[model samples]
Target: MPSTNRRCPTVAAPPQPTDPTSRKLLGRLSLPERRFVADALRAETVGGVLLLVAAVAALIWANTPPLAESYQAVRDFHIGPAALGLDLSIQHWAADGLLAIFFFVAGIELKRELVAGDLRDPKAAALPVIAALCGMVAPAGVYALVNVFGSGSMDGWAVPTATDIAFALAVLAVIGTSLPSALRAFLLTLAVVDDLFAIVVIAVFFTSRIDFLAFGGAVAGLVLFWFLLRRGVRGWYVYVPLALVIWGLMYNSGVHATIAGVAMGLMLRCTRGEGEERSPGERIEHLVRPVSAGLAVPLFALFAAGVSLSDESIGQVFTRPETLGVVLGLVVGKTVGIFGGTWLAARFTKAELNDDLAWPDVFAVASLAGIGFTVSLLIGELAFADDPVLTDEVKAAVLIGSLIAAVGACVLLKLRDRKYRALTEAEERDEDLDGIPDIYEEHTPEYHLRMARIHEEKAAEHRRRAEAAAGSRIEGDRPA
Candidate 1:
C-alpha cells in the first residue's frame, strides 16, 4: 500500500469587474477628504464652468475701469522666502513648490493604473499605450513642423503633449449623453500615459544645471522612500517626512523640484484590483485627497490661469514661435494628431470600435483631448521663463486649445444625443424590460420626451409663422 498525500484546493475569490466602481464602502474619510472628494468630483464635471466663472470674474475685475487696480494688485501679490531669504521665484513656487501635490496625486493614479486600473492587463493597456504614444508623437511632430524656422521654435515641441484632466473631464460631463463612459475611460488612460511621458521628458530634458551633491541627496531620499513603501508602510506619516526631505534636496539638486513631485507619486503604490481598473481613493488616497484636490489644484488654477491681456498681447504671441507653436499645436495639431493617430491605429490594430462612436465622434473626442491648460501652463513656465513672449503664447494657445476641446466635445455630444434618444424610445417600447435602470437618465431630457411631441411643437411653430406670413402677404396685396 502506498501512502498518498493530497493537497486541499483553494477556491478562487469572486471576480471583480473589469473596472471596479469606487462608490464602495469606505469606513470614513477625514472631514476634509469628504469635502475635498466632493468638490474635486464636482470640479472634474464642471471645471470648465468654474473656469468660465473665474474668467468672467477676472474680466469684470480687470476691465471695469475702477476695479483694474484690484486685479493688478492680486497678480502682483508676492510671497515666499523673498520676504524671508531665497531666490526661488513666485511662478517657481506655484509650479514647483505647490503643484508637487498634483504630481503626488497623479503618481498615486499612475500606480493604481499599473496595479489594477486600465494598465492591469498588458493587453488591455496596449490600446491606450499605443494610442497615447501616437497622441504624444503626432502633436510634437506637428508643433515642430509649425515652428520649422521660427523664433523660440525649439521649445514648442512639448505643447501638444499635455492633456488637462480637468477640462477633459468637464467635456465628458457636458457631453454626458453623446459619448460613452468607455470612451471617457479610454481618453483618461491615454491622458495619464501622456502625462507620464511628459513628466519623464521634463525630468530628463528640461532641467537647469545639476548640483551633484544635492542630486545625490535627492536620489538617496527617493531610495529611502521606495524602501519605506516596500515595507508596506502606507501611512502619510512615513511619506510626509521623506517628501519634505526629498523636495528640499531636489530643489537644490537643480533637477526641478516638480520632478520630486512625480518621483513621490510614482514610487508609491495605490490599492487597486487585479485585471481591473481601480481608483486611488480605494486606499489611503483618501488621506492625500484634500491636499491634492482641495488645496493644490485650485491654487495652481488661481495662480497659473491668470494671463495679463494688454494691447500688445495678441501681437506678442504671434511673433514668438514658442507661443504660436503651443497654440497651434494644442488647437490644430491636437485635433489632427489625435484624430489621425486614432484612425490610423484603428486601421492597423483592428481594434473594436466602441458602439455609436463613428469617425465624427472620434474627431470630436480627439479635438477635446487637445485641451492643455494646467499641465501645459506649468510646463510653459518651466520651459521658457527667460522669454515672457513664449509664455504669453503658451497662455494664449492653452486658452484657445481648451476652448476648442470643450466646445468640440459639446457639439459631438449633442450629435450623440440622437442615438441616446432613439435608444430611450426603444427601451420604453419594450414592456418586459421593466427594471432596466436608466444610467443616462441624469441627462437626455430632450430624449425622454416622445418623438411625437418634438414633431408637434415644430409643426405648430411652422403653422404660426405661415399664418403670419399669409396675413402680411394679404396686406401687401391689398393697398400697401
Candidate 2:
C-alpha cells in the first residue's frame, strides 16, 4: 500500500532569519493556521455584516415610536421550562444560550491555535499575547479611571475590554483587501487571547455566588465530555444532550453557561490521528461555525444591541462617566494599548515586525481592534444587569465607539490598501515581463508539472470532441 501522507502546499517553511536571535512578529503562517485564517475570515466577514444589519435593525426597532414598546415586550417575554430552572427572558436566552455556541466555536479555535497553530511556539505567540493582554488592561484601566471620580459605578469596567473578532475581521476584509495577511493573522491571534481573558473575567468577576452542588455536576459532566472524546465517541446525539445538561448545570451553578461550551471545546482533540485529514476539533468547528456565525451571533446581537437612541439616551451616553469610559476605552485605549504593547515588544525583545508590514499597518489594525461590539455588549449587560438605564447607556457607548473605530480604521487602512495595491501592480508588471505567469512564479517544479498534466488532459478532451463530431458527420450521410 502507498502512503497517503502529503505535505500541504500552503504550509511552507518559514523565511530564515537574517540574524539568529531576531524573530519576526506576524510571520508567515503554517498550513493549518493559514487554512484556518482563510476560513475564519470568510465566515466572520459574513457574520460581521449580518451582525451589523441586526444591530441596525435593533436600533431602529427600539427607537421607532410605534415599535419601541413592541420591541421591549418581545425581548422581555419569558420562555423555557421552569421545572429545570431554565426559564429566562427572550433576551437572556439569546445572551446565555446562543452565545454559548459562539464561545464553543471560539474555544475550538483557541485549542487549535495553542496546539497546532502559531501559538504553539512561545516566541511566535509572545507578540499577540502581550498585545491582547495590554489591550484588555488598558481599556479596563480607562474605564476605571473615568468611573472613579464620576457618579457611575465601576462594575462596567470589563465592558470595553473585549475585541469582537467578527466585526474586526469584517472591517479588515473590507478595507484591507491589499493589506498583508499577516495583519489578519495578528488580529485573529490577538482576539483569541482577548476572548480567553474575557471568559475568565466573566467567570470570576461577574458571578455573585456559586451553588456548589450544581458546580460540581457541571465539572463532572465536563469530565465525562472529555472522557467520551478520548474514547472516540462520534455521535452528536450523545454529546448534544449531555452538553445541554452541562450548560444547564453551569447556569444553575451561578457561573456563566458559556464557560461550559468553552470547557467542552478545549477538551476536544485538535491534533490529527495517523492517516486522518482533520482532527475532531476541526471537524466539529467546521460543522458548528456556520450555525454560530449565521444564527447564534446575529440573534444575540439583535437582542443585545437594541438601545434607545433618543436625545436623552444619547445625552446620557456622553454625560455618564461609565458610558463615556466605554467609548474612550474602545476607541483611544484599544488603539494605544495594542500599538504601544506591540512597539514595546519589538523594542525590548528579539521580535520585530514582519518585513511585509510597518508601524502604520500595525496602528491601523490596532484601531480596527477597537470595534468591540458583540462581546462588549454581553459584558455590558452582565455588568449592569440590575440597572436597565445604565445598560442602555453602555450599549449606546459600544455602538458609538465601534462606529468611530470602524471609520478611523477605514480611513487608515484605505490609504495602506492603495499603497499596497500600487506595489502589487508594479510586481505584477515585472512578473509579466519575465514571461512567467505570476501564479506559477513561486510554484515548485512538482506543482508546475501537475498543472501541465491538467492542461494536457483538457487538450485531450478537446481532441476527443473534435473526433466525435467528425465521426458523427460521416455517419449522418450514410445512416440519416
Candidate 3:
C-alpha cells in the first residue's frame, strides 16, 4: 500500500526558547519527584513510631497523680496575640496550627499521585480508588447506623472514616512481613484517597459559618502565591508570610484553618516544562515534609492523644454509644468495606487484583486499614469539643480500635510472610547445580526470554564495538 510518488510534507518542529534567564530557570528545576515521595514515606514511618510513643506518654501523663494536673494545665494554657483573635489554647494550636503543616505535606503527596504517580492511570488506580470510596462510605454508614439509632450524636459520623497511614505502616514495619510491593502501593493510594475524602468532609460538613470577606481574602492570597510561583519566585520570605496570611484569613473565615494548607498545596505548580529541573511542588514538599513528620504531627499527637482514664473506667468507656460505634466502624466496618469493595471491583469490573497477591493478603491489608488513629483522633476532638466525657470516650475507642486492627494484621501478615519466605528459598535453590535457579528453569519460556535478552544486549555491544574499530582504522589509514 506504499505510495510511490508521494511527497513527504514538510513539518516544522516547535521552536525552543532561547532566552538565557528563562532557560536557566527551567534548567534549575529537575529533581525526580519519586525521590521526594520516598523521602516522605521514610519520614512518615519514623513519625509513626514517634506518634506511638508520644500517645503512650501522653496517656501516662494524663492519668498519673500529680502529672495529670500538669498535663491538663499545659493543654489548657493560652498565650497568643489576643488582638488578632489568636489567643488559643495549646490543644487548639496543635489541632489548628500544627496539623495544617501535616495537611500541607499530605496535599503535596496527593498532587504528586494525581499528576504523575499511580493515580495518573485510571485503570491502574481503579482497585484502590474504588476501595477507598467504598471504605469511606461503609464506615460512615456503620457509624450513622450506630449513632442514629442510639442516643449518640450524628455529628461524629466522619470520626471513623479515616485511615492512619503512618500508624498502619509502622505496624507493618514492626511485623516485618513479606508482602508484595503492590500491596503497599495499594494501601498508600487508598490512604491518600481516604485523607482527601476526610478533608472534604471537614471543609464542607464541619464548617458552621463563613465570613465571605475573610474567605475571599484567603482566596486572593492563594492566587497571589500561585502568581509568585509561576513567576519563578523561590524565596521563603515571599511565600511564608503569604501562606500565614492565607492560613489566618481562612481561620478567621470560619473554615477549618487546616483546609488552607490543602488549598495552597493543590495550587502549587507540579508540572515541569522543558527548561525546568524540578517542579515547585516537589521542592516545597522536600522543604516542608521534614517539619511536618518530625515536629508538627508528633506535637499534635501529644496534645490530642492525652485522654485521662481517671474519671471513667474502661468498662464505662466501652458502654458509651460514641465509643462502641467508633470501635465497630473501624474494626468491623473498615475490614468489610475495603475487602468487600476490592472483591466486588474484581468481580464486576475488568480491573483485576495483582497476581502476586492472594485473597488473604488483601484481607490482612484491609484489616490494617482499620488502624485509624491520627485523623480519627482529630475528628474525635472536633466532634466532642463541647463534651469532655464523650471526647475521652471517643479517644479511648480510637486507641482500642487501632490496637485490635494492628494485632489482627500482624497475625494474618505473619502467616503470609512465612509462605513468601519458603517460596523465596525455593526460588534460590539450585539443586541441579545449573547456573540459574531450578524454579526459573522450570518456567522455560520466562527463563529463555530473559537469557535471550541478555544475549541480544551482548551482541549489540559487540556490533557497536566492531563498527567503532572499523571507523578508527579507516581514519588512521587516511591520516598516514
How far residue 113's Cα lies from its native spot in candidate 1, in Å, is 1.2
Write model 3 residue lDDT over 213-246, tens digit each, in one string. 9999999998898888778887888889999999
lDDT for predicted candidate 3 compared with the true structure: 0.77
The per-candidate count of clashes, in order, stands at: 1, 0, 7
What's the candidate order when arranged by decreasing lDDT? 2, 3, 1
Model 2: which ten-residue window has the lowest total lDDT?
A: 9-18
Each candidate structure's TM-score, on Cα atoms with residue i matched to residue i, is 0.72, 0.86, 0.80
Best by TM-score: 2
Error of 2 at 97 (Å): 0.3
Q: Every model's Cα RMSD, please? A: 15.8, 8.7, 13.9
On the 0 to 100 scale, the lDDT of residue 408 in model 3 is: 88
lDDT, model 3, position 168:
86
Tens digits of per-residue lDDT, candidate 2, 1-480, equal: 112143652232223223436587766555456557878878888898788889889999988999999999999999999998998999999999999999999999999989988789898888999999999999989988888878668899999999998887766656655544567788888999999999999999999999999999999999999999888888989999999999999999999999999998899899999998999999999999999999999999999999988888889888889999999999999999999899999988957676656788889989999999989999999999998988988999999999999999889888667445643343233223344423324446755565677789889999999999999988888954
On the 0 to 100 scale, the lDDT of residue 395 in model 1 is 73
Winning candidate number (lDDT): 2
